[model samples]
Target: MLVALDGVPVGSQDGTQLGTLIPVTHLRLPPASRMEFIVTGPSENVKSAQLITQAIVTGPNGDNDTARTLATLVAREEDDDSNVSRVPNVTGPPWTPRFAGLATAAVNTTRRLYFSENAAQTQFFITVAGQTPTVFSANNPPAVVTTQGSVEDWIIENRAQENHEFHFHQIHFLVRSQDNFAINGSQPVAAIQGQMMDMIEIPYWDGNPNHPYPSVTLRMDFRGPDVGDFVYHCHILNHEDQGMMAIIRVLPQP
Candidate 1:
């Protein structure tokens, strides 16, 4: 059988320019099966699973079914559940403490200016207001120098329209908890059940119409098998590029 892709003749094997035949000994087309040609090629660098997932071929009679299957597969990947979710404006379930904020200031100082002097310059929306990037006090950074296995509380905040994933590049830290404990305290959002990732996913919750905002908190372990300058940013690429990123220097044990 003849096969062409995008109007160009395609050879099954790049090296030998051989085409796979459905009725040939190498490939047999079952009556109801939608998959078409099965091309045999060098398997040096290909993972067995990847080969199956990315396998592709073209053939006659099953064009419509092949297209349908391919479309479903592509859609599933796009909606990968592995990806962290962004909180929606439309509420879901029951949640407390919303943390949504704009990339830039949404309000300004008035006559009272109660919480801060220049509210815009002085304060930042965070999961915890006590952290340095938010409070800017002398004790903002309590762990200037910390040892491995030393318990340091890294409070991550989510002050956006959607949830964000905070990732630690160099070292994988133990996830302590989420949105439960305070920055100054030592407990977790929940019981330390099992081991988790160095990455923390902060969920956003929309507040009431009377007062609307959303945020979540995360506790992280600073100890690591590898330590150096590492990046902390929102897994969402757009937010990181827009300044939702920071750097952390995991100091050696002293």
Candidate 2:
């Protein structure tokens, strides 16, 4: 059976067919990836259109080689304006994203720190990845970055079965040491990496050469003039709409 989603063929369960998945990256650049697969033969009348642009954290489903859904944090309704600008403050040492990656849960339902495969709990602030309610719950939550000239190690984890190009709005990073390991263990010192992206390309959770998991190591550089509240998330349109999105507020120069 062909799983035609939004007019685009994603995949089939029979293991005899393939579909086109759009990779939207750098919102300004549109779709920049094209994958050709031998699915029942390449016939005419096939639509030549792009689907998504950037990274969408997704995993493999039970019966198909295709993806499941976009990984994201729940968004507030259009009419809701109470917590939109909310900014939760951190008093102690800034919580390192690497440390958050170490948070654990008792069961699949447990969303104490990091998210699991379970959909319902994935939105919770499991390991501190993005700006979550628990992390930024105040009215007009201040930017996580403090004074200007602040540079930090931002980890773009490919937990989804796919890979992603995590593009940033103002900074361009360098490739440090692309690697992979248990993303949910207590190893704050352990390094996690992938290809360095001026625009971080986060592969989907289900992405792999033969089950691809392209983890890139990047060194993000942030300074003055470009410091402000800007978006730093996936470039895929549909996935961005789902919840694969976030904002980063860079402090101004002193």
Candidate 3:
């Protein structure tokens, strides 16, 4: 179980420090998601505190994430390491982001992908646009292909009834936007926008056909030196084992 600190989020998983710290009491982290936060030590008057996680319901039929205590926090004695550096109360000085120019960088291509599962939830798929959904196989050709140094934008929609985590290997992506979800007042979503991350969660869609499926748009950067085939998939072990994954081939730059 991943423990969430009851404090302020200072940085994201990809090491992009936030311009401003966002205070949160309970941070929800899905599979493969990561966050960095600052937790102040307990006051002298406080004896101990428990680090715990709250229960979460992924879907109507999905497994339950049970709440549990992870550890006990106790204040240190006055004589114990007075030289220990104190955690700053304020957000630190500004710094440039690693992908500072990515927001406005020219997009080389755009693609759409979606997640779907069968009624029995035994089979799963991550399908590219204009293609038939098929179980993932190593023998299968790459579902998507691109050349190195290309910046592409992908829209990933979740058509399943249970939540799905989108994870990419070999590179991180910037989350551009979220659509068709009621997140107008979500502090976590607001705090995470524009950060580079290797994983993100797409909420489950209701069965109603009139309701649009939940989706997230991502800005993928393939400008790094790495080149070759890598797989992107739902981080959930069961889902991944059931074929909710696909390969992307990144050709070497000429």
Candidate 4:
């Protein structure tokens, strides 16, 4: 089903404010799935309008099953719009209460880990100046080791011609910085760095030394129950099959 405001379906909701204007250009919805959106009037003076939900169902043999109107919404104007206006603004500065200590730990225990694809773009490996690149081997030693109660920062660099997604199995990480040739910057506030994600994208590098390589600074958290051996690799399946993956060991802390 599609949610349309002013006869247009918006792709996705990026903001959650009640009265904030959200642009609806174009959107596509798959069958049997539900989607939610915040619909706002195109203009303040346009008091009354229709909200239409349409469902397009397709059959397995490339034939159309049904095209039907799901629901019609009638927007009623209130005598006083003051109630909507009085709602407190919800979007603003980052919430920093729980992030202060984590930020400090990340800064103090920073660890750098570099990743890049082999020149053939078939194998994945981590690079260090003095040592040979550590290529993938199921029985090979763990490329990275950390204590179970530590937080360490990893600088993941992408040297492949195509984009690769970095993923870890047992623990999530915080994106401290996302920088490369395109946008060279950090999160607006330290609080915004609190996002805990298990995967993130590493943009492609053209193999130019002068140009900044696409990299992400991730603060990995091992303070949870995750321990023993786990794998971190390029989420791309073919890349992983071709040797772009490594094992990481998290030792139980004393």
Candidate 5:
């Protein structure tokens, strides 16, 4: 499913003190998934406006496809005092977007992270090539081991029916791209590329070969005081408890 504004889907932010809602061109949501976003009215001059768009869903078998009117957005009035803006003095490094492909290409080490639900769909996993899948075990091996200061690109793939949120501890990462088969851009993907963020949403697969699978490309930042073993997992607490989490060991920079 997709929720868009002005023909463009908007992007959502991680749950923070000060929330932000950006008017985007497009955004996608997988089945049984949810996102929180704010939409601005079209124009006060028009009194009200409407958004006419369509949504496509797969049949029970996951083969047959159908499309219908997703929603009709209506403009609303806002409080006069709610239109205040303030810019805080931020310190440290400036946030910027790191383009997709370029981030992985510049780094020699790239980790491919794949996730899927068990046959029952009640459990999930993080699997790496040539390694046993990591489940919800304290003894499970680390997903990826790397040194601090080393730049790495993690291509995360979601092979499940429901959508998932990817989150990590300590440092933030740069989102290269978030695209699956059904929906792609809600915000300026290019602009958000280099910006620092700790969480991302991965859409669900529509089971369409032409659409490809839902995935997110990210550049992990390990250049901070955070050293030693940490964890990365689905932001959804229920999913994390169901084994949708993994450890990532960051050794001191060599």
Candidate 6:
């Protein structure tokens, strides 16, 4: 859970400080996702505060994560001379977005990928555009091949009834946009908008032919030095094990 400190959101899960603070009661966190928040202690006569997570219904067939208390906050006396120091107000210079350049960088390729599952939901597939959907296996060849130092925009659509988290190996990607997320009422909080992250949750599709499947557009950065076969998949272990994974081969720059 992304716990808001005093009901305010101040930073991104990727460690980038948000340009503006957004007030939110709580934020949903999928597996492998991270977030940073600043919680201020109560100034007045509040005895204690509890940090808790409400139950989350992942999907029709997904597990219902039970609500739990993460921690309890108790305010110390003002006159107490304990060594614990209070959290000070933020006073540094404004934060600069790490992937600011990617916002305008020309995208070398635009690709469409999608998630699907069998009728019984026993098997899953993450397939590339114009290819047969196949379960992931070590024997399978790289599903995607790209050259080093190239940037691509990937639109990942979730066609399943349950949510899935998209996780890329080796490099982080900027979240360019989320399609049909607001309509599903699961849009990301303002603080994480445009943030660079390795993993993000893709909400489920409602199976309506007229409505588009929920999708997230990411700007993949393959410019990093690492170049080899790496896999990207749904972070959910069960789904990945069933077959929602694929390999991307990044060859050395020409």
Taken over the whole model, the C-alpha lDDT of each candidate is 0.34, 0.38, 0.79, 0.57, 0.60, 0.79
The full ranking of all candidates by lDDT, starting with the best, is 6, 3, 5, 4, 2, 1
In model 5, the worst 10-residue window by lDDT is 1-10
Superposed by TM-score, candidate 4 places the C-alpha of residue 121 at a distance from the truth, in angstroms, of 2.6
How do the residues 1-254 of candidate 1 rate in per-residue lDDT, one tens digit apiece?
Answer: 32322122223312233333333222212221123344454354543322223322211111122322222211232436667766576666533211111112122211110011122322322222443443323333431333443444454544332344555555433333355223212123231112233444454423223422222222344434545555555554444544444444566776
Q: Which candidate is the best by lDDT?
A: 6
Ranking of all candidate structures by their TM-score, best first: 3, 6, 5, 4, 2, 1
The number of clashing residue pairs in each candidate reads: 9, 56, 0, 0, 12, 0
Question: What stretches of model 6 exceed 4 Å from their correct place?
Answer: 1-23, 76-100
Query: Residue by residue across 158-216, what tens digits does model 6's lDDT show?
Result: 98878998988888887788889766545654555666778888888766677788898
Which is better, 3 or 6, measured by lDDT?
A: 6
Where does candidate 1 stray beyond 4 Å? 1-145, 180-193, 209-219
Q: After best superposition, candidate 6 residue 68: deviation in angstroms? A: 2.2
Count residue pairs with overlapping backbones in model 2.
56
lDDT of 4 at 55: 43
lDDT of 2 by residue, 1-254 (tens): 22222222333212233333334222222233222322242234443333433432243421122333333334333556765665356547633222111112111111111211235423322123443433223243443444445445544455554333455565544444444433421111111122223443433344344533335545555533576676544454434444444455666776
- Of 3 and 5, the candidate ahead on lDDT is 3
Best-matching candidate per TM-score: 3
Candidates' TM-scores? Answer: 0.37, 0.41, 0.84, 0.57, 0.60, 0.82
Which 10 consecutive residues of model 3 have the lowest summed lDDT? 1-10
**Looking at model 6, which ten-residue stretch has the lowest summed lDDT?**
1-10
lDDT-superior candidate, 3 or 4: 3
User: Which stretches of model 5 miss by more than 4 angstroms?
Assistant: 1-105, 183-191, 209-211
